[model samples]
Target chain A: MQKILNDKLVVTADIVLRIILYLSIVASIFFLGKMLLGPVLGITEYKSGLKTPIEFSVNEQGTATFGSNQTVPVNIEHAKGLFQIDRPVPKTLMVVFFLLNLIFFGLILWVIHSLWMIVQSVRQKNPFIVLNGRRLHIIAFSMIGIELIQGLANLIKMLYLEPRLNFETIIVHSKIHVSIHVIIAGLVILVIAEAFRIGVELKEEHHFTV
Target chain B: MSIRINLDVMMARRKISLGELAEQVGITQANLSILKTEKAKAVRFTTLEAVCRVLDCQPGDILEFIADEKNENE
Candidate 1:
């Protein structure tokens, strides 16, 4: 019964990984298409509209009154100069950014492929092979690479692109928020890869012992 | 590296085939082959005892310790 349950789990995991792999491929293709046709199709403009918070007052009866009952005359700042898509420099930078995104997605696909290989090994009832250990290591390192790329991409956008566009207002709001959980998860995977390496060595020793 | 198994020599002396010795010793022929080929990392006490019993020999008779040439030279 335990064997049956294990088999079922393996199958389910394999199916899920395969689905994710297919989805990643499709998304990558979509991104590639977007990158290729973005300039020609006038989709290169990355617009971030400003949002104003609505002010309201609440009474004891839970009745709310909006600050503006009529059409309010407000000074609107045009952010056209912030993202000058017509400029050659920003256009090239945006293309490069999209290319970096493609590379990031490619790395993700590679990680998924490595994990798929590991699941295949498990399904074969030989998960402790040296190849699986190597695959785990690849997955761990790829995850770290993905995180680094994401951070670098954000930094480039915030530091270089934002300043080049003279967007002081937008730069104040832009911040690089690195996910600690992702780094921790990568470290955990690295440890698991190390364990797999030890397991492979032990398995080889056990095989030769007899 | 010099601790050698004389299982093949003992089996030859006893006029017993590998299969027969393995069957009498209650071990797989493949494992017995590993012992004979001196490829096994270590032998279990129970396996050694069974092998000795099947061959009608002492443990020392089937196992030999030879000094390494490097150690001897040193």
Candidate 2:
């Protein structure tokens, strides 16, 4: 059978992925540098946006009544659940959030780099190399790291803002949400890495068989 | 490995050069070298038959099983 990588489609895909990887790296570096150094230069604003869920409760009861419960008329003067608060954030918390964002960005770069390397290997018709397996492993772990850092950032933001704000009817709360799909995607990559490892071993064995 | 390929000794006994043997056996010299150097992970029945026919020897002459010293000690 002809190698799939020899096809024009695969060549095009490899070129496209390489371009995307380079662009993502350049853009991430530029944004991360601006976020990290702009404050020191006194050019960046201190305003940060925080998005959290809000529970609404009303004191006035409506005429409609359910079984053992009265309907309360709720007025939403502001945004509803999962609303954003745009204000100045404390420097310490902002710095910590920025650092977390930086780590997440680095993980994203690693994932793209690994994917590009894997595509390059495929283009070379040596897809079952040990290095590709290691790259896949790196990609898997980096995905998990990105998820964990995002969750940590969300938790930190919630913890920092929960006690400081006081509201009569609206409860601003943030919960650390774990994305199961991302974790599963990472696990699928891990399984692909194992398959690549086994393929490499089998290829080596076949190569030596005489 | 405990199972070793004594192909070099057999080739020497038969006075057949590596190039000649590889050509007669219908395989590449690099692959024949791997078998001769005991670096082969496996031997196909067809390849073993061809090598035995070329060397005019039995399978026992090319392959030998030696006890591992570590296993014996354990």
Candidate 3:
């Protein structure tokens, strides 16, 4: 397996992940610079996209006019509700929202960085290094942390905007949601990290068994 | 480790160089150096037999066990 896959597939994967890691780092730096400079440049309106739960009341034709003077096209299958949200928020809310997104991006970059290191180790034919196990543990924890921040950010945004924003036919619901599959994936990675640690120990034992 | 390798002592007594002994024992000089310096985790019976045959000494002449204070306390 190593003979066939190690030369092409693993190297390609390592390169791809490395590229993504570098790009994400650059993007994060750009985002931070923009956030820091935007207010100083007299740009206070925070224009961004968000998805949230809503309580909607449709008219006789089963269509609603959103706060932004836009008509939401009601689907024939689900004529009573609309899912998409687009709004310009306050500067403070934008700062919090952008910070949360930046943190989420950072966590994703962390997972990518760890994955790239592990793949690089495999490319070098030394995947059982003790540090690789720690990298896997980092990836696992970062995954869980990403989900937690997502849920918390969503809840905070919902609660903060609940009383302030006035919509014509829709009310945003303050609901906190987390993806169970992502948490389960984090737990699985943790188990894999433990197994990798044990494998590294066994490899060390074999190395010194001369 | 409690188990100590006395390979250097045995080699000295036999007047055998590391390269010469390693070649005679069909092992690498680096591995022989590890064994001589007590850095090895375990010795195979084959390697021990070859070392003994080359040095004309028993296995006990090359390996010694000194009880650790930590182990004694435990």
Q: Judging by lDDT against the true structure, name the best candidate.
A: 2
DockQ, all candidates in order: 0.46, 0.80, 0.70
lDDT of 2 at A124: 79
**Mind giving the per-residue lDDT tens digits that candidate 1 earns over B1-74?**
79988888899999999999989889888988988898887788999899889889999999999999999999
Interface RMSD of 2: 0.4
lDDT of each: 0.74, 0.80, 0.79
lDDT of 3 by residue, A1-210 (tens): 777875899879988998889998998887766655553233644334555554444344456788888887664332233243354556676678677878888889889989998998888888899999999999999999999998988687668765666778554445566888999999999999999999998888877765
lDDT at A4, model 2: 55
Please list the residue runs of candidate 3 whose C-alpha ends up more than 4 Å from where it truly belongs after superposition: A1-6, A39-102
> Which structure among the candidates has the greatest TM-score?
3
Give per-residue CA lDDT, model 2, range A123-191, as digits (tens).
Answer: 777888889999999999999889888788777766777777778766555568668799899999999
| Per-residue lDDT of B55 in model 3 | 97
Clashes of each: 0, 0, 0
TM-scores, one per candidate: 0.67, 0.77, 0.79
| Candidate 1: tens digits of C-alpha lDDT, residues A1-210 | 999998999999999999999999998988666655664244565222111111122222223445767444444332222233343344566566767777899889999999998998889888889988888888888888888887777776666654444432332334554677888888899999999899888776676553
Q: lDDT (0-100) at residue A205 of candidate 1?
A: 69
Q: Which regions of candidate 2 fall more than 4 Å away from where they truly are?
A: A1-6, A39-95, A166-170
Chain A vs native chain A, TM-score per candidate: 0.72, 0.76, 0.75
Query: Candidate 1, after superposition: displacement of residue B33 in Å?
Result: 3.2
User: Can you tell me the CAPRI class of model 1?
Assistant: acceptable
